[model samples]
Target: MASSSSSTKTDPSAQGQAATQQRLTEAWVRLAKQLTSSKDYQDIASLVAKTDVLALKNEKLERELQDALTAETRNLNAIQEVKNENMAMEDACRQKESQVEAAQMKESQAQSQLQKAQEEVAVLKQELDSNASKITETVNSKLEKEVQIRRLTEEMEKMAESFRQTEADLKKTNQANMGQLKMAVDATTEELNTLKALATPLKPQADKRIPSLEAIEHDV
Candidate 1:
């Protein structure tokens, strides 16, 4: 009886092993059939290759996008720098225009000053000419007066010399007349003395005959 029981237990174990092996064998058979179809195998290989190619293209597109973004940033910075330079040029231009205007105003003022100076110089020249003419006229008048005085002095000297000559001629004629009158008076005195001497002699003679002569004369 113990031997028969051992045989029955052995039979159950063997049956279980047989079932597990049969299921494994069926799964293997189905896998082998699926692999053996050529169309299915080719379709799987083409699909795998297409997936790899898509992955490579996606990576390249990402790199190009990054480069484009970098270029756009650089362009923006360059545009900002140009705008700053233009603003500086505008400020410089405005400053130059203001300086030019100031210089022009100064030039105009200088021209005006020059014109005023010229007018002053002309006035001074005219005044100087007038003064010179007046001085010349005064000098001429003085010279004429001096000439007239010299002529009058010469005339006075001539008149004085003529008067002296006439006085000398009158004095000589008076001296000659006085000498003639003295000679005539001496002659007259001598004649009177002779007559007196003769009359005295005659008177003595006549005295004797006086009486007779007197008588005769009385009768005559």
Candidate 2:
């Protein structure tokens, strides 16, 4: 009876060790996900069909990786767009610089033409002034010639009036001497024949004065 009672007491210790082993098995199965429970075994078809926890978690990870790849692609595209805009702006600046160079060349040509035109105007003005001075000198010479002609004509007319007055005084003195000579000739009529013979010498000198007007005008 003592050995049998001792075995019964030892059986309670064995039961306690068995209970601890059962809890360790359950904790290991829960941590490592072993398909141990009969209910877990039966639920496999339902879990796989509904996309159980493992597959759902893998799908979420894959989705996050794909979104990260898409964001990287967008950043690269923005950098390329900025590079293209900078190239366009540089091309526009080159075209503006070319246009400014062309404008400067045209301005230089205009300035040269203006300087040539100014030189031509100055030459023309000098020629005009020279011609005006020549014309003034010619007019002054013509005026002096006209004044000299008027003075010469007045002197000629005064000399002709002095000659006319001298000729009229000589004609009156000759007529008075002829009247005294005729009265003396009548008082000596008896001696007139002999006196007339002496007067015959004066007859040739008187006949010389009675020359024709045509002969007198020809002598003058």
The candidate scoring highest on TM-score is 1
lDDT of 1 at 72: 74
List ranges where model 2 is wrong by over 4 Å: 1-72, 145-220
| Global lDDT scores for all candidate models | 0.57, 0.57
> Against the true structure, whose lDDT is highest?
2
Tens-digit lDDT track of model 1 for 1-220:
9988887675677788998899888878887677656677668767777777877777777777777778877887788788888888888888888888888899889889988988988898888788788767766654554443334334333432332333344346564643433333334323333433434433322211111222322443
What candidate 1 gets wrong by more than 4 Å, as runs, is 1-66, 138-220
